[model samples]
Target: MTPSRARRLLPPLALGSVAAAALTGCGPDPGEPWAGAYVNVTAYPYFDFGAAAAGQSHTVLGFVVADPEEPCTPSWGGYYGLEEAETTLRMGEQIAALREAGGDVVVSFGGAARDEPATACADPEALLGAYRQVLDRYEVPVADFDVELNDLQDPAANQRRAEAVARLQEERPAGTPLEVWLTLPVSPAGLSEDGEDVVAQMLAAGVDLAGVNVMTMNYGESRPDGQSMVEASAEAARAAHGQVRELWAAAGQELSEEQAWRRIGLTPMIGVNDVPGEVVDPEAAAALNAFAREQGVGRISYWSLNRDRPCTAEHGDPSEANDFCSGLEQEAGEFTRVLGQGFGD
Candidate 1:
């Protein structure tokens, strides 16, 4: 196993006793884990590279291409300012970013609309047919893709996606991971209500049975009335249909309320006011880090560095890239510590 990275000691702010209490007495125990962040290469590869280079551990990123031509072709997409033959150029660059930073990389597939038409995966069988090609391209045990029962909302489509995921899981050598992107709100009831009977449909289809990313930035509309940060996000996630049941099936034990979230997922994948009606909360961010540790969640990803922009609000002025960079740099260590690195820096 990789040695536990050193930890950080956060300087005290004018924290409330409650905040102090919140921060007190909890972190993952000896065997719990901490993972790094997912840098989205689509926005700015160089910047993404730089974030990994800073030594945060366990990076998961997507070099997604908005290339319409090879839409959903997995490894062979033909856009993103470079030609198709240059994929290794992309992967090689990402690999170097991690190796140089002492991190491991998981090549991601599917971004908002980057792989639309997903012509290659229109249905279950076609996707199974195309798996080997994607696997060979990324050369990683975990092949990442977004499969949401929320997206299609059609029961048949959800089932088709599930079967395809199951088939891929079966085909891959054991231990190879399959991660799905989930965009449900912080509560199952809200997700079920607004997401067109999400709970019933997904449970019936057996969708979301694999690992998940839980796409968690909410500018609002998608998030229902009172859910914003990841603690709420995680609570919402656990409340989903079949989640606890799925936990039972996967680990053969009932996940204590705390353990229902072991999937590699999203966290301060930061969002700011740029998300209309969205605001920032350092306290919530802290709670989120706390929540992940409490649940023994597997991995956490930030939806993007590009969206929140760090602006003067979170970091500094938009033009000064260092503002954005520094903010992440400052929080990264505390995040690492909260996520469960042994000692603090």
Candidate 2:
């Protein structure tokens, strides 16, 4: 979708202001010995084979499925899952590639696009059971899920879900960790000098969280501020940690107890869709990765490994879906390989 001329005028006008802001699957890619290091390279509806090859490690690397329905389920994310046969099969092909790489891929349970709060909220056991059913279907012990108060507040209900997962982890086998992804928006609505607004809730929910992913790339339809998305995200994670877990650090940058919660993960977008020849300077990507490293946060996920860039940034069109990422998707090719190099395996 194209942006109206009026909205186009807003960015330059507010340049000084600014703002910001999962899991599982598969085997590691073949090329390197990157094992056990967290990597999240994804596709909207499919994971590109080429992209996976570059991002995989012997350790940990996975995909956070986009859950976009009432209570969007990440494993169910993308337009392809519901298809009768053909499309679903195509999606499975991507899944197969992820598995072959020795990476653990997971479909994220929630995101900003999700609206339906946890219907199982009132009954803790029921929610856990329901989520478990998800595990049964995917054939994985746990799925990466996010917890924001909009759906899981009310301390009574909150504790139930938390207890369930914490129990699940303690009881489950050694390798399983219910990783989750949450956003720390530059939009002030979710972020703060301290990111406590949502952290308390997540911690209250459970223990043994494989990790947390804070999306610091700040391009949203609402486009709040034009500040440093990287900085805002790092701060939020630091503030989010409570008694249950400790903030490791930002994705590449390190932080202090006073600054922000150490994010468990970072998602750097490779221009969403790259400009034909722009090849978005690697320095920008490296700086973000480096920042996360400083924070002690070691994982990184790219927005996607699928989709083709059908347009160009020169279009001046304000983009309907947070245009910043409009150009990143493409057929498996050179761009995918280039984007995968940041892992430093």
Best by TM-score: 1
Candidate 1 clash figure, as a count: 9
Question: Which residue segments of model 2 deviate by more than 4 Å?
Answer: 1-75, 78-93, 116-122, 147-149, 152-160, 175-198, 219-263, 268-282, 307-325, 328-345
Worst 10-residue lDDT window for candidate 1 reads: 1-10
Candidate 2: count the clashes.
Answer: 66
| Backbone clashes in model 1, listed as residue pairs | 7-343, 7-344, 7-345, 8-344, 8-345, 186-236, 264-299, 269-302, 312-316
Candidate 1 residue runs with Cα over 4 Å from true position: 1-34, 44-54, 63-67, 75-89, 115-120, 123-126, 147-150, 154-157, 174-190, 193-210, 219-231, 241-243, 246-259, 263-266, 271-273, 305-345
The digit string of per-residue lDDT tens for model 2 on 144-256 reads: 44433343344454455456566655656665544444433333233433333344455555453444455444434333355344444445444443311333221122333
Candidate number with greatest lDDT: 1
Question: How large is the C-alpha RMSD of every model relative to the true structure?
Answer: 9.2, 10.9
User: Looking at candidate 1, what is the lDDT of residue 225?
Assistant: 68
lDDT scores of the candidates, listed in order: 0.43, 0.38
